[model samples]
Target: MRKWREIFGASQTDVAKIMGISPSVVSDYEKGRRTPGVKFIKRFVEALIKVDNERGWVVCKELIKSLNLNPEVIIDIRELDKPMNLDTFVTLVKGCLLTSTHSQKIIYGYTVLDSIATIQSLSGNEFWQIMGLTTERALIFTKVTTGRSPMIAVRVAPVKPAAVVLHGPKKVDPLAIILAEKEKIPLILSLASDVNELVNSLRTYARVKIIV
Candidate 1:
């Protein structure tokens, strides 16, 4: 429950208002003092759908897909100069995939974001802003050290990107690899020395549109 809350970037107050329940009840659920019944769970999911709609993101759409719930929405997809898959993306950036369930997934573009900036300023609502153009894009995280923290942020997101590229990391954290595999989001570690150069190369090659 806590994990889902964090992923949605919803506060107890937000959930309480949407659920028409008390904030203490939400906190109790997170604290494991009580468990939500099936009826409450259904309401929780419905509330999440409402939150997704308000946030202008398909996060709950993806969540519904993962659950085989068949959420229907008009997806906005775009393409770059050529189809960019995980394999080609890694090669172009001189990186390696540590974990991937779908290597053939195609992405329209890339967005280079500072990991620290995200940690500091990005709220759950702002996730769509950072993704830019569409959610079906690659998110390249700069100033990454362990690669764990940023990937954790992605895992908690309602909509997962096609792939995640971590720049300036020689080796990625094992837990980060696990999180990516669990989410089925491809995790890549780039050995690129210069973050600016790598971001520029990706933008030019992928023709990525920056929304945020």
Candidate 2:
């Protein structure tokens, strides 16, 4: 309900887009219009966990090897193992909250294995799936790591191709394009419609940031 939105800082529109349902559908769920199905429930929980790892929790510890800090943290990141002082110089995350008001997170359902899905779909992400992976990613998550926030928002509904080829998989990296526009996050694209392509795209774009 209200707690889910608060936990993820997700607006109704955002959640609806994620859920592949109308904003009205989301509203109904919020209002208890329909009982959430198992798939819906699972996605919700996953999203909640992901958001929590990004934004909440009890006081956690972080290590600063260098005096510098990156612009921000990402969901899947890599790390090196080393020894460090358990108690020493550390900075506190400002808005750290441990127990959320709710026990589950929500998922807006959408997936696509093909890049060309864009020409035929209203939401590309709805059909997109993890097309590929180069390496098992590290759990480089964020937890209330705030700072001068990135101020960028782009309304990406759908883009038209000059010509539609009904044969090949629609080659589109909707996620890459969206995240790139907003947060300068990296992305990996694929020529195929599969999870491997997605993974490869992620690996390919891991450090190549787009600055608008």
Candidate 3:
């Protein structure tokens, strides 16, 4: 309950107001001090969705879109409690920035993907699941060869990630760099040893709070 409220960028008061309850009641439910029945749970979820809808359905829409994605394509996905600078995320992943673009540097979340599985399994519309809860997140592609395919997919997608990281690729394709620059999306090459190492690094980073 707390997670959903936070993901929607809503306060306990906000959800309580929408659900016609007191803020303390909402807090109690989230803290497990008070058990909620099925009817309350339904109202609680509807309240969160209503709050999100009032705010343009940003998080709500993304979550719905993500349900259609294949589990094999997405190794991991998480939303940060606070936004982190793009540079900090790059450093944590031992990444090298290939593109000069810096227009969108703040990221709210990350999604780690199996490069081959994603490219082969997802269609055009389903590809947006890579953004997870928001487009302001890093899309890390693992098992990359030339890094061209992922970049190409991003180019055709309706939305773009704050940054793109290629893992397991010693050399990135020149065209991928060009596409990233054209889109103004920071292109990164990660030096993490493997997918497990990469995911662990990101998990550690997510636990740390960044003031910015």
User: Which is the leading candidate under TM-score?
Assistant: 3
Off by over 4 Å in 1: 1-79, 128-134
| Candidate 3: 10-residue stretch with minimal lDDT | 203-212
Q: What is the C-alpha RMSD of each candidate to the true structure, in Å?
A: 14.7, 21.0, 9.8
TM-score of each: 0.58, 0.26, 0.68
Best by lDDT: 3
The 10-residue segment of model 1 with minimum total lDDT is 69-78
Question: What is the Å distance of residue 48 in model 1 from its true position?
Answer: 32
Better of 1 and 2 by TM-score: 1
- Could you give candidate 2's per-residue lDDT for residues 72-177 as a string of tens digits? 2112331112211111100000111111121122111111222222223323343111111111221111111111111111123232111111112233333324
Residue range 5-108, candidate 1, lDDT tens digits: 77877777888898899999989987989988976875675565456667765575565345332121111122355667778888876788788447678876
lDDT of 3 by residue, 31-117 (tens): 999998977986786677667767776875576555776767777776554678877777888998898948459987788889888
Candidate 3 residue pairs that clash: none
The C-alpha stretches of model 2 lying farther than 4 A from their native spots are 47-212
